[model samples]
Target: MNLRRRLAWLPLAAFLAGFLPATPSLAAEPGSENMLAHRAAYRLKLDSVRDNASIEQAEGIMLFEVIDACDAWASRQRFTLLVGDRDGNIVETTSDYATLEAKDGSSLRFSLTQMTGGAVTSRVAGEASVTPQGGRIRYQEPAATEDELPPGTILPMIHTIRSLAAARAGQRIFVAPLFDGTSADGAQDTTTIISGGWLAPQPNANFPLLSTLSSARMRIAFFERNTTGQGGGAATPDYEVSLRYYENGVADELKMDFGEFVVDGRLGELQTIPSPC
Candidate 1:
């Protein structure tokens, strides 16, 4: 099963929180020209596992293009991911577009297109509530019938990136685990996610057109395992996610390491869009 399927069998609260920030500094306000330079295209390789055993693993190459960005909001960002399996075979792919609106808090609207077996099989749309400390996000797959998703569903990693961009420096944020209390068969699996931190700004490089940058390093722990049917004993797994953002608070790099599995991705490949006024 995929990441989303595994998480679907868990609990609803798993959607709560994820990611953090850094120490205080007189940095350029979020979304400055200095940070924009860091924005460019990159590739990723991910290893995924359960109970310390390899379940599914893939290497993904992605192109992230910045559509538009202003002091008030960033709009028109696009991402495409081509994923390959352990045997170096292309197994699945995803493409998505996002628009961010900055209010008292931030908000993001994004849609994902999933391709498998050389066909587009599913599309997902979701929104997230963004805050200075952390945020909450919820998504639904139109291909699925019920309002709630099943356990073990590895939802896309995009929401995690959105949450990090919304976080301010020196604040705590919680991301609900991937599993929302219901399984594919409608069973409840309880799990919790604890997260906290702030955005740390990085100095500008030789590139003058780029803006300053900031990053958040997060630690995640999964409590209470439900291994009743899998035959394996219950085990608590720990994970680490490191996120890097540019153009003030837009995501540019995302790295997730679950000890057993690791995913490293970068955003690039710019396309012009109507600038937010």
Candidate 2:
């Protein structure tokens, strides 16, 4: 299954907002007023993805909103995802609602809502049983079969930002991308990276205001190669992934332009999740 298809379990609209510009940093400087009041929203535009076999193009729209924030303590977020094709016809759309609160040391309570299709169907709802080691997020729910409930929903994009904030600059951290289990393909289509670079401080802005603060250019791509089974395997590919955080790192605006993919011989998938206007 493709990355976007696997991500379909959760609301696709929310993740697209990660492409927007970065927000001002809420961390206060020495002797400076505590201007790090936490709260932010982001709007983003969905890009196009080409299907190699069908030669079809898919377009989408995404919105992300940070309902609550207390820096490293806790946060609440919501997202909406919509997808279409070259002719501007609606393909599929849904929404995902989530909340993250710090539990014990290095642990958190993760919860989510599953919305499917354009009609906003309520598939299932659940929380994580136990936090993964090293602050990693490890939660799963069964497939949305007629007999069983939908898999444990997750917000991979928000978890990425949370992982970033939990660590100090120059420190390396491993973030487990959101996985619904049902979409795990034989090719091991997962990507990982070590990102820790300079970020400009965000300017002073009135709380709950929408604005572009800072921008950073970074690299994101797949690492390990698949070699065990059939099909092309074992050659890692590289690409450029740029991300912009808004509202003082409470939200993100991301842009990932994969020049090409090796195994599939097709372009990478790009989508946007924006906040409600």
Candidate 3:
């Protein structure tokens, strides 16, 4: 993937929200106001390189925010990366991604903008709806086009809820297609591998919101639609993320695989916002 495409996903402080269900119901009820409304800062640095990817050194920061907007969840992610190629050429890439998801998980509004060398390269803005027949997206910024969402598709927060449910239910693996409108392509297939069962409360006095919640270790692989898990063995993922997911919706010790290189995103600071209900 080119830098523009990579930016669409590489550092998703997305779902910047948190959730821990009382039971393994697997249903998303955004109106419950269980999601943590907070902002998190992550320090990003190169963890490894692969395929001879050009990288003298790379560093970045990702700022993530999730707000409870009365009847919906609003999230925004700001990411900036400075990369030094083999010959000492420096390129700065940045992206702003934002979304508004309804309380019922029935609708979503999304926008993503990417820049490289201070020049705008891509912009994707759209609205989508989930229905019994499936989902459809209507793009308004880049162009006027409509796309179909595969059946059984889900939005990001619901994906988190379902994954948590499956994890709590002792299911080691879960597969689903997700549409967050981060890219022009409507939905991407995902395979979530639960590394272990629930985690006991790990004390964190500095971040009181996550102090007493259970957590799970999960690794998720994102793939191009219909390119995986059918006939041949599992195809390589376009992007992969493994993290320590807390019941309160905080993810720390993030390892993001960007095809050519991997980046680690560790939480640096956190503050919870009171619900404005």
Candidate 4:
């Protein structure tokens, strides 16, 4: 993946919005107000670099907000990265993304815009729907494109719910294909998750909201789902993320791995919003 594509995924914080069951019923599906409406701010710090010698210093901020929209979940996220290279010059990359996911897990719509040096450099917008046969996407920006979603495809919110349910049931590993409209490449992602079961939140944790809910530590890896076997079996992931997830769907203590380097996102502020419902 190119640097732009790798950075594009950083603005996908909405996917981690809280999705825990309100009633503590294992069979219960998330409904209105089940997902906590909140905004979280994070400090983006360089974790490490392996192949990217151009980077000397890295810093930024990420802001993510999610709201309960009755029958759908609405979200907005932005991330800005300030990079100082060996040349003693700084470059700024900013990503802004918004999304809506139907509560039924049947549909998702997204818009993404990326800016470099204060100028719009790229845009991707699309809608995806799930059908009995499979899933499909229709793009409306940056030129039109259409593609079929691989079998057993899941959208972001549903994917989180599935993960939460699995954790609640004491399942250690889960795998599923997901399409979050982050890119126009039409590559579906297959995610594998190894999870530690639920535990009480620590008082010293950065996000106070976590203290009111059950939590788990999860290591998730993403791999491209290649149906035609064209993408060699040894194909590595585009990226991977490990984080602490709360029963209410909040994720913090994030470590994002982009093959060449790693970035850490630490929660700096968190505020719960009133649910309209």
Candidate 5:
């Protein structure tokens, strides 16, 4: 599925964005697909706030879905958050993000729109390619411009497929430049941390498909390209997401750290869609 999505503030949508992937071709190998095509609703709330933080309270809901479109994967996510500041004033923000990705890790189309107080604040839409020699990103909205993606750039779906396959194969971590079309930056260097090893099929009684799949716990951090942190090494990540993910690509129990405050996403609902395969 993907480490995918972004909210207007997107702190919520952003977490899911990390997990969602673009569409994969029907030729995808077994055990590397999205596994479960499903719609998920996550309830979000303040997990914590730094003492000096301006955000005193936060609450929101995220609606996300992934569809098996036969030849490719299609996904849509909507995030809305009502945040209260130290002054006790409330602000509402929302973001809508969507994508259609090829199954062979060759291409992707993405769109993201953000609004605050019911007015559009920002929008970005584009198409990108993935290849061994690097690819190009052609932005079609907000402005007409093109950028070069660094060599070895992988889109979300392929990144997830490779990551999961590695984890299942006993590899602990891997770093890659990921281009999900979520930000203006052509690609962000991502470091994925896998933990708890690979799990056995514990079977979720609530979701039939989950009952047959093994799972993993992972944390992924997104770092801006060419940026350095305090010690002159890699810069601190802009955001971090931790979640439990199933082999079929279903994710639950999420933690999103947005610097100012942290939010948690609890899966309130899940329904798997039938795949054409």
Candidate 6:
């Protein structure tokens, strides 16, 4: 049912002017030239569990890192989820997911490996290219599968840029196709609802990490694309995520809702990495 893939969602770091204009160091994207690089850790805890949710108790640690690779943005998310089943047994699952996207937003490469009870459960590797008409992905793990993305679609990193850009431009809502390699379902249509507004510097202990940055609240909903409009407006979303996105692309205060249950992740630690142009 691609359960593990569904668990692989996102959570970013970096400056206010980083998106204002493209500089040699700050090339206007997360992984561009001299963009913000940082490592962040979060503590995940169960929020609300529905009657159908098999998860009884969920607690884990999530570590995320973003590196600027000159022409590409390199990102990795290492998560360990401890799940308590109804049978009074606990299973520890770990997922290591990484991706590299070109700064020009033309291509993306992704790898995901999931281990349950210290055993590998799934591995998915793929690459996708964006074009004027749409995009295509070539998967290499589990089984080779090819999928198509519609026109006006955007990848993960580019989605971050565009969302932040929209917030800066006073735009409230945006709909786009996103391919994060988290699922075999290829590209999912996403609608981003943006709120909040730019604010002056804050008294954050993280200093440049959060104090000097502008921020906005964003809720992104994912849905299966409907080529046939027969479903009409009653279609429900597959999943939904809401977080605070920084001007520099870093996100925290994550709440992931899977309909039956909810998981909350709070930032525990954050460190900015020096960027080299």
The most accurate candidate by TM-score is: 3
Give one digit per residue, the lDDT tens place, for model 2 in 1-277: 1233322222111211222222233452221121122333444344434345321333343333332222222333443434344455544534454333221222233334545454544332222222232123333433422211112222333334433443325444333333222221211223334354435555534432323343232333432324442322235543334454332343344554433211111112222223222
Clashes of 5: 22
Model 5 lDDT-worst window of ten: 7-16
- For residue 47, model 5's alpha carbon misses the true position, in angstroms, by 0.7
Summed backbone clashes in each candidate are 57, 28, 1, 4, 22, 3
- Error (Å) of candidate 6 at residue 152 is 1.3
Q: Looking at candidate 3, what is the lDDT of residue 32? A: 34
In model 1, the runs with Cα more than 4 Å from the true position are: 3-39, 46-57, 65-89, 99-110, 126-169, 172-215, 219-240, 257-260, 267-276
TM-score of each: 0.47, 0.45, 0.88, 0.85, 0.86, 0.85
Give the local distance difference test score of model 2: 0.33
Off by over 4 Å in 6: 11-35, 51-54, 85-87, 206-208, 229-234
Candidate 2: Cα lDDT at 202: 55
Error of 1 at 256 (Å): 3.2
Off by over 4 Å in 5: 1-30, 203-205, 227-233
Model 6 lDDT per residue over 1-277, tens place: 2348656767332111122222122244443332467888989998988887777787888898887766667778888878786788888888888887767767777778888889888887777887768879899876798988777667787887878778778888977877787766687778888877554556676445687777888888888875653321126888888888777777768887867667798888888877664
Error of 3 at 116 (Å): 0.7
lDDT, candidate 4, equals: 0.71
Better of 4 and 5 by lDDT: 5
What ordering of candidates by TM-score runs from best to worst? 3, 5, 4, 6, 1, 2
lDDT of each: 0.38, 0.33, 0.74, 0.71, 0.73, 0.73
Using lDDT as the measure, which candidate wins? 3
Q: Candidate 3: global Cα-lDDT?
A: 0.74
C-alpha displacement of 73 in model 1, angstroms?
A: 4.8
lDDT of 4 by residue, 127-165 (tens): 888755678899988879898877677777777777777
Q: In model 3, which runs have C-alpha deviations exceeding 4 angstroms?
A: 10-32, 227-234
Distance (Å) between predicted and true CA of 258, model 4? 1.9
- What is the Å distance of residue 202 in model 2 from its true position? 6.9
lDDT of 1 by residue, 1-277 (tens): 2433221111101111121111222332332332231234556666455474433565655444333234222322223334444556655545433333322223343344545555765455554444344344555545333333223322222334334444543445443423222222221222222234454455544332234444555444343344454411136443345554332434445665545566676554432344443
